[model samples]
Target: MSDRQRLLTVAFYLAKFNDEAVRNLGYVNFREAFNELGAKLDYSPNSVKNRRDDFDPLFGHRAGWHQIELSKSNLEIVEAFDHLSEEALRAIVFDLLDESSSKQGVLLADIVQGRQAPSYTTRGVTGKKAEAFFINWFQDHFPQDNLIDTRDFGCGYDFGVIGSNEVYEVKGLSGIDGGVLFTDKEWKVAAELQDEYHLVLVKDCFGEEPTVEIYSNPHEKFSPKKQVSTTININWGISVSEFNELDKE
Candidate 1:
């Protein structure tokens, strides 16, 4: 709520915009994210250069993000960071095997020159809550009492049932707009592995009536309805039943 904080918040938003743009443009490996941030922030091009040796003293080896310096006429500012707390930021870079898999992890160089790390919380609704949520979700739809058969620990499918004669590939639709997506592997695997590959999309998790649809024969050739709610349209350009049999017993 302070002047510095307000300015920093806008800077981070622009940083996220720049990073996401870089990823989407298929220049996923480039430094476009940082460059875009500098451009949007109106930082001098020459001042945007980063030096690793500068952070070694203060942040220690934990400082993994490239540090870019911003030079103005009299104001020589060398700081950058995102809206995330530092505890959240470090776990992404050092903890995760390949940082890209981390949803919490991001290109950290955008963090301003002198923001301190936030204190760590020993207890949070992060790990166990996540596992518990998944368990409840699976049980709700494919309850043990109702299921024909269920197996754990590297079961061949995400979920399999004998009575349904289907292989279910369930995915979280919480992030995307009330719609879902299937990877090329999931699409092909679903088609060839079983007679019917049910892409059971779970949306509006706690909302009044959760929407559930069965996508049968989800082949890559079969483009399902992607009723993405963009600026205008409300539903998909394609439908589930176009290629797959829907809600079959």
Candidate 2:
């Protein structure tokens, strides 16, 4: 499924729960919930409400668009998440929205290099928010061709713009000036792709107005200093006896 479809499915599920979903997500009301989620998902607020109304009939919360049948995508969503309890489904939604958690592996590498990792919450800009900004900006500035989301592929770049060889790596900052972190794989890919790779920075992402700065061939544009540190790595293992003892407990 496309990233947008996944987001729509999440919104549909949230709509199924109605007011409870709004409360659980920390929104004062459905309007606020729709607006916030719309921004994060790079969709219009009305679209979110439409998706919600599409699913509302199934739950019998209110008179929704009962004239039309559920689309194949909506049916798939129901089949997939129908078995989950409200809490479990909400947890899944929360995890999907918490894009910062995806950086844990990169943060570990930074720690190994003796660099202090920045707290995600303190940054005041989340990965999802930055990505949404980039998506909207790309759609506006670039050709109308598709921009494929490669985040789940573990690729160095976050998006591959169709009809071109260019790949975009997005970084979000609360302000115009701030340090951006890169993973080893991303660095290597940037060097390999050279001019084909682009570094897209979204600045002032937490503010009403966000700005986009694009650098083509970032590896050639900036020379980054590499830091190394010698540290002991610890690994813990349990034997069969220990496992059995723990299992008994």
Candidate 3:
């Protein structure tokens, strides 16, 4: 299948899982088999019986999810359905479905292949994936708080909360030992925000479920720090273990 079709299929399946009618069932039948569900176990049968009604609208009433399995290279990527909002995913899928190059899409384009590239850098991709994980986590755990993605704002913070004064700067690493880099502007912003600034460090971003550690007003915690360079290599750095101690939880 084409990449467009594959992405759309994933998106549709995600939406179908969210559909209320399908969710009313205990489980859904993908290949003529019943699967145990976590939240809506009783709705499995209903989902199968009302399959057509569920998907009639294309995207159904968003519902609880149990699991979603997709193939990634030689491995199958299996994750629990946990998104409260599929808007980003839907938008990405729709953009891919559109054949017009004039339109800007979520996934970045590769210069050589002229196709959507997952990410430009390995670190960048890891950080993005981790951000998505945190977004889901916040939406699920802190339903009262509205989290906004502000990474594109170049405001030294990756996310912000609506109706709140808090801001978050996220640093993601594939392992627990990686160093966190902060630009001069980001350091200035962190110092300015002080207590309102949150430094979120995610470890093992691409492994299973990523681990999150948050530090409030992290600028105050760094001690015996030194600037290695002022010209091209100017930046503040810290080890993941040192940052983990600041975790509120």
Candidate 4:
């Protein structure tokens, strides 16, 4: 899809959520939301509003362009995403808006293949939100300390405290109590760091009032069992002979 079409589709989904979208996106009003999103996507505010209007008819939140049939692209977007619940669609729209999200590629690929995109698990979205909350909380609570984001580096921790021998691994739980997983690398790193490694757990992360608990040297404090799992990857390829035969055809 053209970039404009993609942006329009995202805007349409956002519109379906109406006030909830504005609040979740931290916009005080719809006009501001449209302006900011339009600026981010390099489109005019009016275009965003129009896209929202295209979807408003189906949702009945506002009087939109309902006199005529939806454009083919708009109709296609509706058909693809209309069945999703608000939370599910919000996750997808958020992913699509984020240029750096790898999930965007998977979702778009599935859409192009005429397949239903896999539903995003609540845990996945909640983890991201919790991480964001922790980043902000860390900045506010520890102004003297500097945190280097190591999440993308896969360094067995999410943040490394500069000028200190400390690293922090973050975990999020939607409710007060839930299980957390650690990869082999994280476990090894925690064992090595011992006193310096920290586990920052955010509880009720998806709720209005989230709470945080920090465990220093979690490797020593808690005894977690080791569970092993295996995954297999499959790839399909044509042999040279088969390729040659096809070429001859």
Candidate 5:
């Protein structure tokens, strides 16, 4: 990449990380990653300006102008954050996921990342460097039953339910080495809405047999790497009726 593009890429990921960090109140890793990338892209410390303005009428001030200005013409490429190769994208995304946990409290963090999977990871998690793997995988394989009411927004890998009596949160665990990851904030939400959280473990290259488990409650017994709350709000009882069977074993 040209120096200009490199500069822009650093700025771009920096902004992305910062945005999420703010959501997390202030993530040190996000700040650190932002700083690291900023330096790598040859952005001097002064280059980062942490505010956007609404000076223009048509469009409000955009964030990360210093970096975004690189792709002034290819708006879509910049907008999509799709400039990176598949591996690069995954690495960047994983970093985002990693930093997110610290933002939320400990319980929330655990709920998000502590999702369980089979001890064995399937071919579904690893393979050729498919850049659009999650997108394509979902579009190709997710349940298309209209009666089931599944839909794709051409958005990111995370998918959700609609109405009140709704069911799950199916995020693509594709391309991961079979471990699970989630932001602490997301985990808090999942634990709060545990009845709906589902880890769409698409393995065997997202083969037909994707592992499906509905987590209506966070496991109290299992230890979380980091939780969203300072105090543990663990559920000692196996509440999910489905899990009651497993509890007995």
Candidate 6:
């Protein structure tokens, strides 16, 4: 199944229990949920756990504070809706499953980064907000420039600019010195695209106004080593000392 489909399946599975599960809230056992979801979805228990890892943050619910498993190496926890009402959660899940491209886009962005930092949950909704902020700023300054959202393509880049023959891997950082995480696919894309690939850093995104730093030909500027088999980490402040600052409104 496609990544989109897998996420939708998970959403669908969760919605099934909304009526009865609402009562459990903070007390629902994750194992029970996983068993039913995995059985219906034909997924392994581990897969259900993995999907919940992504869902916990999206749903704005966490159970680690209460349900703790000493035997499970990863510390199995059960999380349920806390931020939104059960009805609201069901509505959102339905919206996502109804082929809502925009909603899917937002959720996909959150999932792309894997389990998000807890601080991100505290900040606001989906990563698309930050990405859109930067895109808007870029469009305002370079009105003639054409751009394409490459996020759905999973091409390791967020956007592609026409005429410039360049693609951008956009990152939303908390500050100028914040960390930027890239997937292995992005690194490979950057290596292959080389000078044609750029890294657009959108910093101070959670603030009233955000600043953008565009690193043209990032593959030539930053040397990012693999953090894991699938992730790459780059410290922007240390790698690119000089980058053109885009004027923001």
RMSD of each: 20.7, 15.9, 19.0, 14.5, 19.1, 19.0
TM-score of each: 0.32, 0.48, 0.42, 0.50, 0.28, 0.46
lDDT of 6 by residue, 181-238 (tens): 5668888888889888888777766567778888877768888655432221222253
In candidate 4, how many Å is residue 165 off? 1.9
TM-score: which candidate is best? 4
lDDT string, candidate 3, 118-223, tens digits: 2112233256666878898888888999998888888998999999989988877665555566767788899999999998888777678788899999888764
Clashes of 4: 0
The lDDT for every candidate, in the order shown, is 0.37, 0.70, 0.51, 0.72, 0.37, 0.54
Ordered from best to worst lDDT, the candidate numbers read 4, 2, 6, 3, 5, 1
Model 3 has an lDDT value of 0.51
TM-score of 2: 0.48
Instruction: State the lDDT at 206 in candidate 4.
Output: 57
User: Please, what are the lDDT tens digits per residue for candidate 4 over residues 1-249?
Assistant: 456656766677776889998888778998898898898778898889888887775666876754334555564565566667766666666776677886654655456434232222122335566788899899999999999889989789889988998899888776677667677899889999998999999987757888999999988898887654222122357799998999999
RMSD of 5: 19.1
Badly placed stretches (over 4 Å) of model 2 are 1-125, 228-236, 242-249
The runs of at least 3 residues in candidate 6 whose Cα sits more than 4 Å from the true structure, single-residue gaps closed, are 1-126, 229-249
Best by lDDT: 4
Better of 5 and 6 by lDDT: 6
Candidate 4, which ten residues in sequence have the lowest lDDT sum? Answer: 115-124
Stretches of candidate 4 exceeding 4 Å from the true structure: 1-123, 246-249
- Candidate 5's residue-wise lDDT over 90-200, tens digit each? 343334345353332343333323233233322112312121344454456655621233334322224443433333334433323444444465566555655444444
Candidate 3 accuracy as TM-score: 0.42
- lDDT over C-alpha atoms for residue 131 of model 3: 82
Please give the lDDT score at residue 94 for candidate 5.
37
